[model samples]
Target: MSASATTRFGMLHGTALGEGSVSVHQYLGVPFAEPPRRFADPIDWSAPFEGGVRLAMRPGSVCVQPTVTAGDGFQGSEDCLFLNVWAPAPSTVPLPVLFFVHGGDFLSGSGGEYNSSRLAARHRVVVVTTNYRLGALGWARLSEGRANWGLKDQRSALRWVRSNIAAFGGDPRRLCIFGESAGASSVALHLLSPASRGLFGAALMESGSPIATPAGAAEELAADFFRHSGCGEAQRRGGQAVLSCLRAAPIARLWRAASAATAPPPGGGFLDQRTFASVVDGVEVPARPFELVASGALARVALLGGTNTDEGSGFVLPAVKRPLSAAAYTDYISKLTLRLEVPRANLSDVLAVYPPRPAADNANSRGNRAYLYRFDQRARDDTSEPVDWGVTHGSEVPFVFERGSWIDSGNTSFTPAERLLSVAIGGMWAAFASRAQPLPPAAWPAYRNGSEAQLVLSIREDATAPPPFRVEVPPRARECDFWERLQALVRDKEQRVAAS
Candidate 1:
């Protein structure tokens, strides 16, 4: 059956997914911002359409970035600030809205990649996902005023949702901004951003935290981009000439330069020195997000955050390719500590706290009504062979979206217990969005400073049974304490260095 919704700009014709009561109305590739000018902030979409009607059936073009499978190649366009929406059919009352951002290391990914139909239909919530600029186009610090355009694009999308979601039977007042990995980091940044205040009522971040590229590192990345893009002469010319040269360059040339600038160094270290990330721009980002959260400078909103059991596995496994030798592991640790700005004197202490294969931990929020969770579910292949990745980064996304069964084939289909786990996770997320609490007092409790309680989501070996989701204090408490101290030491050193 066909579906349509009248947005502020025009009437949008969409399509329906599934059938009967489980069906959801999906509107795809809706523009939330105008076609962006290179290195400029996103402009909110407000003008009426010429025909007063728009076809939102197909997915929008993703932002320009290197192809995921092969980094050497490029795909997408600069004009890719679009969003998609999924709303339950036959809903009389306005449902809670969940606006999601996709994660791609600030390099790649789009909103179209995630299908939120299961979330919308099963949980009776309105789901929205949107694309932002990526790679150099999104994060390059070419000019002092032009950094973090991708973040601005997200804010613009939130504004769009606030103004128009009621037309689609969504509650703007009950909006929760949620994302995984890079998207999760973006949500954290929004939580810390002054401009983003009141745009969202709650936030959920999975497997990511509030981190920003230092100003010095951002400058180095920009210089590298200029050198690789054949804009070195423009750099000599200085001022707007550099931006002009970059804007005038071919899209392929820019993509290649971005790839080169952000490429991992020879011998492959644990942390790549050259990286593109959101910066602490004075206006938009104001200050370090982690520090703001520590100092209780965050916006007043309900918070739900989590990480997988083996977050570093995804990054480490892809790079190592083989079992690590003692020497190689030590070398990797040294490089990692250096990138983290840990002083050489503290190397031994850092190593003591973070032994190989250590259990991961989550940070506790002080002032907000927060709930934390750790996903301990490992992925299994078609033969039921455990995937070596071990609940690696982004593994929990399918469970949270209730799309585990979509990836199944024959015997590989998600077990009954696994399916139940998906339902439980998705339902918790929706409950948190609809109300501040993720679950009833008996199942999950709100996190407090001293209590530090969190949910551990895992399934038992009995495939036909229900999941065993438990709430308890996270493991590796001492390790978390040591890291907190180390972080403070590093921050103090950085501040002193900056002052000098």
Candidate 2:
């Protein structure tokens, strides 16, 4: 294989990573769409490069977002719809493709943060990571007429992959879309989106489900934005005036306003005031995602879904300024429900379902092959004050990517046993992408909707041994049932309010 590859766009000179038998052709910062207009859907890149040859070595700018550290302001640019690709070198046959979407609660992450060279070389697959709009630029329904531009950007990237991945030695038909956290939720939204059908053969979501903002909630978010960004008067003037005011505002000011509006209230949980999720716009998103799944309107593709053992600790614990007493826990729940708009009359029922800690196999019932797993392997936190994150949200990502660590700094070196676990998990994921099965049928069976046949990935108690590949029914089945009922109730209340 040469150092350059030609696609419809033009010739791209990439870097060769690794040496000897293990090597990958890595292309960075490849544009898949044109520079986007503020709050508008993405347009696919059709124009060829000016010079015909381009250097695909450096990473592109991140989409405009707030800095990870608070009070640091913003970084990145609006011209940020770039993607990175990694393919095994010296491949004779076209390989499977794994397209990954990153997760940052729809606010602060980039595709560049994940390096896929190892995953591509070891798994013998083509891996691609991409950027999408975030925050006010990506999600906020600044006007009553527009929503889900970020999701549209993702679909545009997928379309680019379908058209050009074959030139990179990837089988276009054998592509899998996977993501973690908000990315996982994005995958769920794509499954329910009509435009995303037939773009990917399989889908995997880690620690997220199909849920969209109701129309009323989206209006509230817009109002918050209007108030914070000083666009309230413009909004009263009309939609066009408000959009012009917002687009002309300083980028930093817009980010600060978005951060302020989206911040949870005092003693609020992660889900409180979550204004960055995909909105239920009648066009792109069509309807509420969970309702679509329940109605069996989801795409007929191979699906895998799971959550970590302690998914909420990372989001909730970091905000805890005091020890949690029973009264404090109840107060936390109250605030959460209030933000979710659950009526006060039903607070007791909500409390009954959620007691400190608790715990969907919707795919199989619709004739789609589906699997579920729980990542119980805990990561070692070598920070000065190492809180027990307990297999927190996103803990499984490094294992899936076979990387030493995903964070900027920490004692993230994997132990011998963890290295082995990483290999196994990565292999399973690649196998699923290659063919709609993660493992041999005898080893891991397809999940049934109402069964206890979930595959649990965890290391032994001592953490010095290989992962015990255990399959069991997830605990707290009754609690899950109660929560499902509560969600339905909440939806009903929202609907009644909307009607009124």
Candidate 3:
């Protein structure tokens, strides 16, 4: 039969085909680019789910998010840029659309992991997820030097949305781009990118903020990553060598090497610091994301961003490493000293305001109606397993997708409370897509800029309440000012050096 005849049933992204679901349709490995490179145009690529395009059944190529460290021994290739889309066939209404970008510190993640069938089936909306080049392959800075391939890949997908989402019954105009961890960071980055300006109508971020990467720091991190990637030695041979070796390296070899050095907790992923992320590329990326948001660079798109209830609780386990201690935690926090400033006196006040409750334990009260949420479904992990992770980094995916059957893939069951929480989250996400605002059993308040003024969303409590952020807001814009003066000083010093 042609591609249109198999409408009796369809499976979810991560599971076997089911019966209860309505008409299910999938479009795998659709190439958004001509040749998947900045200079090279994508070749004759897969057609959008057009007339009887073979439903290979599931997702397409995994995005080429590569990373490697000399101490570890990983290297990535150019074939990493690609995206996947899923939806219900023959749509009745022009469903609201959601575009998801996975998270991995702007270095890794693909759309394959986020199944939108249940979410689409229940909510009646079209959903899409993508895989972009990770690490140096995507985020590398050319000054070291290299162009930013990662951000470029995302732009390619946005352009694809502009051209083709209508075929899938999705309203391209009513677009919402959302993501978790680094994916959320991407949304923040896109907000600041020239190429990404008018692509989507709204955004939702989970467990990430615009504050994570500053201009100078982001560039230095790329340098350090390059040094770790053996790119420094590769550069000694010439920039071409760096690209040559990386291009030739297989994805598995690269990921394995990177993971060996900085693998994530338990069974999930590693935390290697190789592969650069979005830097203050003179053109694509300007200053910090907040600078753009504050300067009104973002398209005033409706935005929803939040963190999981226990944002960092996942890394607590280590079948391969030592458990983090209070001292280690303190040391870790110290290293991120530049992240947030807390006074000694205010420490007590802040703790009192946030307390050590659960996920998103203490969220800011107001800011933009960023729709902050805390995914606090009672934590679960395999106590018997070598890598027992709790309600962790990627633990909430199944729930949000409404894939209840697969939630506890490794015998990890969530409570009724968790399920209820998950359903609520799924509903809110769907509602947000259906309309710019959240679906309400509860009213999601707007975030006002200033002190404890952010809307904190949670599972148990009113999703729209204000807890307090440990860091102070009305945050001294002094950092931006400091950067300004520093730049001026550097310019003057450069003139002196040049004259000499």
Q: Give me the overall lDDT of model 3.
A: 0.55
| Model 2 lDDT tens row, 170-284 | 9989999999888988998998888899999999888877667887888788788877898889989884898888888988788878877887778875436555778877776
Query: TM-scores across all candidates?
Result: 0.90, 0.89, 0.70
lDDT of each structure? 0.79, 0.79, 0.55
Task: For residue 261, give model 2's deviation from the true position in Å.
Answer: 2.3
RMSD of 3: 8.0
Candidate 1: tens digits of C-alpha lDDT, residues 419-469: 788888888889889997788977888776556677888998785656777
lDDT of 1: 0.79
Output the worst ten-in-a-row residue range by lDDT, candidate 1. 352-361
Best by TM-score: 1
Count clashes in each candidate, considering only residues at least 3 apart in sequence or on different chains: 0, 0, 29
List model 3 lDDT by residue over 1-500, tens digit each: 11332211222122233315565565665556655653232332444434533354555656554433334443334564556565666577788888888876665557766667666776677788777776545665545324556666777787777667776678888888887767766776776566677788777777655533445655655445445555557856764775666556655554544443333335543332333566665666665444454455655566666544444545443323666577555544443333344333222122222211111111212123444444434344334445644444655666677555333242326555555655666677867877777744235554433322233333544434322212223122334345445546766786799999
How close to the true structure is residue 217 of candidate 1, measured as C-alpha lDDT? 80
